[model samples]
Structures are given as structure tokens and as C-alpha cells.
Target: EAEVAQSPRYKITEKSQAVAFWCDPISGHATLYWYRQILGQGPELLVQFQDESVVDDSQLPKDRFSAERLKGVDSTLKIQPAELGDSAMYLCASSLVNRGDAFFGQGTRLTVV
Candidate 1:
């Protein structure tokens, strides 16, 4: 199926290093979102972008996590000085607007030690 793309389905990293992941949304979609899902928890919105502009990033940890959708097509997320508590499932989703169900990628699982 034509779908979203993500890299490094799993990652292992030291607690103080940096890591990055990438995502590509389906064609013709205009809204993109980044979410963090801890084990046994619902997905939490980290950031949202409308086209090339950031719409919401209230939950994102600016000191450790950052994300961007520059061209508004694909996006990248980075975590610097990773913490053990940062270990979780980083998911990427895309939708036509902010109100509907979004198509989700398999996610990148980060494990910090």
C-alpha cells in the first residue's frame, strides 16, 4: 500500500548522545504530526505542522527534542542528549487536515541506556 515512511524501526543509544529519524508522508497530504507513545500509553502529540509552518509544539521538549517540516512534504525529528526516559515509540502521521484520522507510520522505537 502507498503509505508513510520511517527509518530505523528500532534504535539503541546512550543516554547522553543524539539521534535522528526521518519520515515521508503520502502525496497530496497537507498536515503532518509527530507523536510520542510511551509503553502502555496513548500517543501524545509532540508537534504539528500545517504546510511549512508549525502549528503546535506545546508538548515538545525543546531542550531535547526538535522537529521540522521545512518543505511541508517530509519531516525530521531529532533528540539531543537523550535520556533514559526518552525511550518510546516515535510515530509520524499525516492527514488532509488536523481534524481527521491520519495515516500512521510503523514508528521508530528508541531505547536509551
Candidate 2:
């Protein structure tokens, strides 16, 4: 079975530090998404990429967060000057096409102190 790959499954950062997470989607999948989930809440879409282009990022905090898929395969998400409220699970998901069923990776849990 295929799966999405994410690194640094756990992270701890100071209140004003920088952090990053990575994800590699399953082969041939063209739609990738970054989601943030607070412990008791449903995951919120942070960004979405179709191929190498960003198709949606309306909820992404532009001033502190960024995501990219330079080659349309693997992607990276970064947070600059991370804040305490930013602690959450960062999830990466992918589907073979837009609106298709997605497969998710074990999320990166971020803890800010």
C-alpha cells in the first residue's frame, strides 16, 4: 500500500522560534493539502497544491506560515517565529486528483512553549 511520508513526527519549539515540516505524497497523486488540527477540533485546511501550483491558501497565515511544492512531488511547510497558540498537529494529505479520497500521513505534532 502507498502512503504519504512526513518527517519529524514530533517537534517542540520556543514561543518565538522557527520550525519546518516535510511531506512526500504518494506517487502519481496531484492534489496535496496541508491541514492544522487543534486537539479537539476538526482539521483546517492551510494550503492546497495541484501539481506545482498553489490552488488554495485562503486560510494560511501568510505572515507566519508558508508552503511549497517546488517540483510537484514533495512539499514543505514552515512556520517563522512560532507562537504558543500555534501548537497543533500538522497533517499532510494527498489524492490522485482534485476532490478525490485522500490519504493522510501521521501528523507532525508541534508543541510551542
| Candidate 2, 70-100: lDDT as tens digits | 9999999999989999999999999988467
lDDT tens digits by residue: candidate 1, 1-113 = 77999988999999999999899998878998899999999999999988889999999999999898889999999999999999999999999974697999999999999
N/CA/C clash count, model 1: 0
Q: What is the TM-score of each candidate against the true structure?
A: 0.96, 0.97
For lDDT, the strongest prediction is 2
- Once fitted onto the true fold, the runs of candidate 1 whose alpha carbons sit more than 4 angstroms away are none
**Reference-based lDDT, each prediction:** 0.93, 0.96
Error of 1 at 26 (Å): 0.8
Clashes of each: 0, 0
